[model samples]
Target: MFTKKVVVAYNDTDLSNDVLDYVHEILEMHAEIELNIVYAYEHPLENPSPFQRNYDDGAPEMLAYAEQIIQKAKNRFVDLPNHVEGFVYDTGPAAAILSHAHDHHADLIVIGNRGTRGLRELVSSVSRTIQTKSHIPVLTFPKFVQEEFEEEYHK
Candidate 1:
């Protein structure tokens, strides 16, 4: 299917930036795409209550950091013709990303693979979980894979 709306699960890591690079290359080809950059922050100790919506002492700082990450990611696409937006959610990574994708009726979800080795690879990382649960297509490559491909292509 044609990709017009895409949700990018960004965490501000170098690996995450690689995913954005891939999106940038895709945007060069398809400027009609609308991009959504999302960063989900879940408190490791506290599970948010659905009704209460309470936060621990560190929640505010964590939320602020997430906002910053989203902003930085958005800035990278400033010159692009595509419509771009940023979102910071205080929720589980996979759940928050999937919710945003579903709400936006995204055609694809772009993410970064950490390239976890051995048992870690078998376990569910955020990228793997999103790929398994998302209804739409999910595109991802290992860390630095985009840069490696670009180097080869330019040669």
Candidate 2:
């Protein structure tokens, strides 16, 4: 009767891909697990590039990109017996993750951490905030793990 409802707060980062692979490995062992793969994207306030003519144009593109990432993750684990759902939100990553976990009653959250500093701190704060504010368990992958995984994959 053991079960786990996991929320993987994924971005397009390499570390996030590694985390997804780890979750896939786990699912190979325990089939009684469910995944809510959520992606949060924040639109930059800056003016659009040559391709994007307006702010509204960029927002839809960002949402589509986020959805694509979530779709790839879902496809990877589609053969599993458990359920897998993908969600995309315009809010901050930490808030989106926490809200999704709470609403879905997830047992744990898996996030990729780069252990950043400087300006990156503003972006990386999502991992830290999830660790602090989440009522459920949180698992984070460090840069070292990402590097090792990358090295192994390239070999």
Choose the strongest candidate by lDDT.
Answer: 1
Top model number, TM-score? 1
lDDT of each: 0.86, 0.84
Each prediction's RMSD over C-alphas, in Å, is 5.5, 5.1
Q: How many collisions between residues are there in candidate 2?
A: 0
Clashes of 1: 0
lDDT of 1 by residue, 13-115 (tens): 8888888988988887888999999998876456657654554667778878888888899999988899999988888889999999999899999888887
Candidate 2 lDDT over residue span 31-113, tens digit each: 87888999988866567677766656567778778888889889988778878889998888899999999999999899988
Model 1, TM vs. native: 0.81
